[model samples]
Target: MRILAITDLHGNYSKIIPLLQKSGEIDLVLIAGDLTNFGPDEKAEKLIDMFESPVLAIPGNCDPKSLLDVLERRDINLHNSSRTIGDVTFIGLGGSNPTPFNTPFELEEDEIESNLETLINEAEKTDNVSVLLTHAPPHCTLDEVPAGNVGCRSIAKFMDRMDLIVCGHIHEARGVMEFGKSIVVNPGMGSDGYGALIDINVDETPKIDVQLIKA
Candidate 1:
């Protein structure tokens, strides 16, 4: 499967669409978050509707909670939910653990932990490769900012349980990490034309490859 992952798109669709245009045949487009700039939801929807490939997304800290309705109506909201396509099962968690600035979609740390516990348990039922789709990168792994790591601790602990982790929220820290049979990638800030293309070959021996891109 060819998965195009992008994040923190603070409403500059023009910056990233060209990257997609050149990306051969993409099976899926996963937007980590920040599809809008504190949103009108209309603009986000317009961008999303332009995609021909199937999509799944979670809301970012910058996204208004109201954006949930727009996503729900289109059957693309994946927050704290799981969906299966082909041989992959994607589990999504939106929002970030509280930020000092009090962003619109910050969730408390404990609540974030609890939600992941539920999401993990549910996803474990499947034998399909598991992908955790979250807005915040797991703590300290592509999540560091000038102050320190601002990712959810619970996410870090649970990450190894997934086959892959696709996340964003820390634009400056766009990067990738591999540990314990899992790979985690932050597709950077879409408004800046940064994203990643992931290819998964589910043959007798499954393997995955990633390419970070700048449009």
Candidate 2:
């Protein structure tokens, strides 16, 4: 399966059109969060309408909780939810853990942990490859800032069971990492013309290929 992963749009919907146009063929679009810059739900709707392929998305710290309603109206909200595409199971968790900035969609660590645990359990029940989609990266992994790590420790611990994790919150920390058999990726900010293309081969020997692209 081929997937186009983007994050931290922050209201730069215009960038997406050209990006998708040049991305060749994509089976799915995975959006991490921050569709709007602390903006209205309308902005999120406008962005979602631009996509032709199936989209699975979640709200970011800058986006209002009402954005969830818009995504639901479009049948694309992946927050605290799971979806099966081909042989892959995608689980989504939006918003960031509490931040010093106290963004509009911040959540407590325990709340984040609880939500993820429930979703992970559900995904494990299926026989599909599991992918975790979140706005925040796992603690001390790809979520490090200049000061220190501000990621969810619970998330890091859970990584052992996942096949892949797509996240973006720390823009500068954009990159890929490996934990056990899982691949963790931060595709950076789509508003900044950065994204990731992931190819998963689920054959006799399963493998994952990822590439950072500029759009």
Candidate 3:
């Protein structure tokens, strides 16, 4: 199945719509986080409605619980929950650890760690190939910014066993990582039309391909 993963949109519908339009027959679309700017809005809802394929999204730091409520009312599925499409099992988390901005959707490191623990347990029970979707990159793989801080260390440890880890938040490391047997990637920011279009075939060795697409 072909999967198109995008994240850290931060309310830029122009970039996102074009990317989606440019994609050639994607089977599933994964939205990591920051679907909107400050809170829930019509743009996010409209974007969700426009997608032809099944979409799974996670709430970003800028998104409030009200966004979840809005999505639920509209029947859009948000992740922190897992869903299986074809042979892929998608797991997602939104938001980030506490930041100076004091965002409404902040989650502390420990809180995220606890959530990661639960996700790990659920992932362990699944036989399908696992793919992690998050707004923040794990402690220090490729989510580093100019400030030298990478991301959640607990997330890194938690992701150690997954087949692929796809994230945003760090715009620089918009590439892939083959850590031992695991594949880790940060799709970068959506404003520049930087993201990943991943294709996975689950038979035999489970062939997986990733491409960094620019807007």
Candidate 4:
């Protein structure tokens, strides 16, 4: 399967066109978060409509809480929910742990952990590969800033449990890393034309290929 993942859009919908064009024959598109810059729900749908392929997305700290209902109406919101498509099961959670800035969608670490736990239960299946789609990066993995590695510790603990994790929020921490049996990828600021293309084959030895790219 080939997946195109974009994050931190923050309402820069124009950047997505080039990324989509470059990512040919994509089986799915995953939008990590920040579809708006504290903008309205209309902005989110506009971006979602731009994608021709199936999309599974979550809201970001910058996104208004109302966007959740919009995403759900579109049947694309993955927040605290799980969905299986093809041979992959996607479990997702939106929002970030409390930031000093107090963003609109920020949540406590415990709430984030509880949401993830429930999502995992619904996503876990013996026959399908499980992928976690989160707006916030797990602690100290792809989450770093001038302040420190202030990521969700609860998410960090689940690192070894998933087959793959696609996250963002720390724009500078954009890259890929291997954590035990899981592959973690942060596609960076999609609003700035940064994205990632991941290819996976269950039969392959490594099973995952991650590439960071620009629009």
Predictions in order: lDDT: 0.88, 0.89, 0.76, 0.89
Steric collisions counted per model? 0, 0, 2, 0
Residue pairs in collision within model 3: 139-151, 139-152
lDDT of 3 at 183: 84
Model 3 Cα lDDT, one tens digit per residue, 164-191: 8888766677778776556887787876
TM-score of each: 0.96, 0.96, 0.91, 0.97
Ten-residue segment with the worst summed lDDT in candidate 4? Answer: 118-127
Question: How many angstroms is residue 152 displaced in model 2 relative to the true structure, after the best TM-score fit?
Answer: 1.5
Give the range of the ten consecutive residues with the poorest summed lDDT in model 2. 200-209
When superposed on Cα atoms, how far off is each prediction in RMSD? 1.2, 1.1, 1.9, 1.1
The TM-score that candidate 4 achieves is 0.97
Candidate 4 — which residues are off by over 4 angstroms? none
Q: What lDDT is reached at residue 188 by model 1?
A: 88
Kindly report which residue pairs in candidate 4 clash with one another.
none
- Candidate 1 at residue 60, lDDT? 94
Please tell me which model should have the higher TM-score, number 1 or number 3.
Answer: 1
Error of 2 at 18 (Å): 2.5
- Local error of candidate 1 at residue 198 (angstroms): 0.6
Candidate 1 stretches greater than 4 Å from native: 204-206
Clash total of candidate 2: 0
Q: After superposition, how far is residue 192 of candidate 3 from its true place, in Å?
A: 2.2
